[model samples]
Target: MTVNGRRVPVLSAEGVTVRIGGRVLLDAVDLDVHAGEVLALVGPNGAGKSTLLGVIAGDTQPDRGRTVLDGTDLRRWRLGDLARRRALLTQANSVAFPFTVREVVAMGRAPWASLPEGDDDEAIIEESLAATDTTHLHSRTFPTLSGGEKARASLSRALAQRAGVLLLDEPTAAVDLRHQEIVLELARTVADGGGAVVVVLHDLELAAAWSDRLVMISDGRIRAAGPPHQVLTAELVEEVYRQPVLVHRHPVTGDLLVTPDRRGSRPTRTPVAPAAGAALDSAFVKEFS
Candidate 1:
């Protein structure tokens, strides 16, 4: 959207801050989600990536600053209204009741109930299930599905929503290798369809390959935000992740690959205290000599 000839972001977080028990989870972080692109939030554990995502999704209240959707404050929008525009797939896919997979996926259409848009709900649900490879489990109870199945089913729900903005937190965390690639491809498809997709990814290689932009968060603040090639470097990875790594391009795909550098020398001996009887064993060996 453009206002006064200026392009506006579909969703944005400005100076967003969140604190819990005097510990800062997010500190004055700003981010923008634009349509037709996939933006990834990546960092080590407890680096405020999820907290910032929740703030943008309106699931977590910010102690300072604000999050906006189409220039309107997120807090000002009604829950149902927000649900129609933005769908969030959280890390946990737990359902309290024994809802069938189909039933759980259908819940995404609740915001459009009694509206004309509900007419396509069934078709969308089926497409979503098939897209996520969850169609076969539609009749099964969500509680009975395996971890990867549950994750896909939950993703199917978010896809069924048809929201323009998707906030996904580790959508492929529990998925297998094949499904992980599938999930990333789906994210790209969503972005290609003109949706704004913001995903939290732990795998830097996947993020670099999938996302149009990468945001590296550390210590409750954004360390860098830019194109993957610019943001993901060997020095930055080592500094932020605190582990030496080798960042290189894939041989065929040409996309970036990040792997820990395991070239260090191993110690000659174990570093531990000897047992009480170890010296006596040494003396017995000496007697044999």
Candidate 2:
């Protein structure tokens, strides 16, 4: 894919805008997801992060512009072919029916049924389950699983698809700390395997640690885009998130760490004098007497 001799991104939003009921969800956002890199989309709640992801996933159509996948407009690709190229894992992983874990993961292979590797679906399914640490839940019905368990199982299903482009919306939202790392590691692994990964993350530290680049959005527009060190500055954090934050390097991993600047957000309380507390003390005694 090329634009005037420049190589194009694996997936991109070209001047995309989305508006619903007199409110704008996305405002002409231009973004890219490239192969061999994990891109993190982050923002405050209602900042249009998920909506932008939905646009990239083809689940939401923008009011203006278009989503391009591998240089071709997403609307032009056949649904099955598009499924084979890119797999989307939405935030909600609800299964309407009582499908077993293994059965649910196998659904990813539907697009590949006409291909030569269709017969190898079982092996692929098992591999995906093992990768996401959901193999133990293979026999359990998806609806009977816990939220975190269901999250892991759903991830296994997306992994089973073996798509070149992965669009994951908060893949670790329901998992524990350990599994959160596991999911991010799997995303890094996918990129390492020569695929493109675009993830929506609320955890700024995790996004900074795993992503090759970060795209920070606020009020339906991009606030910053670049490496963590460049994009996640104290000014940008405070301005876009509307909260004071301290952006610093971790001592152990040297990764960028974002923490709330509590001192800046509020004033600390000091002890009052005994004389100043006399009225409160008298009231307390009178109430108890």
Candidate 3:
């Protein structure tokens, strides 16, 4: 039922390398994105995480390798064929014209135009807007949105694409605390539904919390890649980032937690027991979820 203990990757980048203006952006990078899994790409700034994602998205061609989607090389697919199979969310989502948020999300349905899939366009658009919490902003012009609003609106468009593989670059970069969890939860739901999601995140703990696997890159190469528990050790974090960090389990959820050492500059206190906040948590979950 599996290929070598895993399902065949829906998208794969093999021996991928990229050079821009004589600088090596990525060097011999290899990545696999499998269905039913969320893969988080994490690293410090300018660590080729985005470059690797672009290669996977077919937006940036590799200098020395090939990218495959569903067992075929990406270059072989037509533009609309490729768009219908995967969706990409970049750092900036700008529309030159004053298109309404509804119109912007509608653009995602273009790939399926003239096909049977086009019949479900309206229902899908509504679902995507609700998923990103952008349903209320549908009538607003894209150019007038705030940073967080624009980010969520852009996410709605990508979701509307209904692609099997989702590539997100810093999807949570402009969101607030609550929306950050929402964005990652959306990514998790996509993977759970048998799609593949590759998200680039700067928040190490969030990446560890949401992803089935973490791929850490630095200086144009992968430094570590594995399940969060196996790859997010304090030694590796400090080594790759050259910054003092403390790694431990969350007090309540037991998820991995990563934080800066701070050189003992702050006072420490005992954490409250989980039972103390159970009632309030239940109320919130019951109301929201």
Number of residue pairs clashing in candidate 3, backbone atoms closer than 3 angstroms, sequence gap of 3 or more or interchain:
0
Q: Which lDDT value does model 3 have at 271?
A: 77
lDDT of 1 by residue, 154-230 (tens): 99999888999999999989999999999989999999999999999999999999999999999999999999999
Better of 2 and 3 by lDDT: 3
Model 2 deviation from native, Cα RMSD in Å:
4.0
- Reference-based TM-score, model 2: 0.90
Local accuracy of candidate 2 as per-residue lDDT tens digits, 141-215: 999999999999999999989899998999989999999999999999999999999999999999999999999
Q: lDDT per residue, candidate 3, 172-255, as tens digits?
A: 999999999999999999999999999999999899999999999999999999999888889989888998899999889998
Question: How does each model score on lDDT?
Answer: 0.94, 0.92, 0.94
How badly does each model clash, as a count of residue pairs? 0, 0, 0
Each model's TM-score, in the order given?
A: 0.91, 0.90, 0.90
lDDT score, candidate 2, position 215: 96
Candidate 1 accuracy as lDDT: 0.94
TM-score of 3: 0.90
Worst-scoring 10-residue span by lDDT in model 3: 1-10
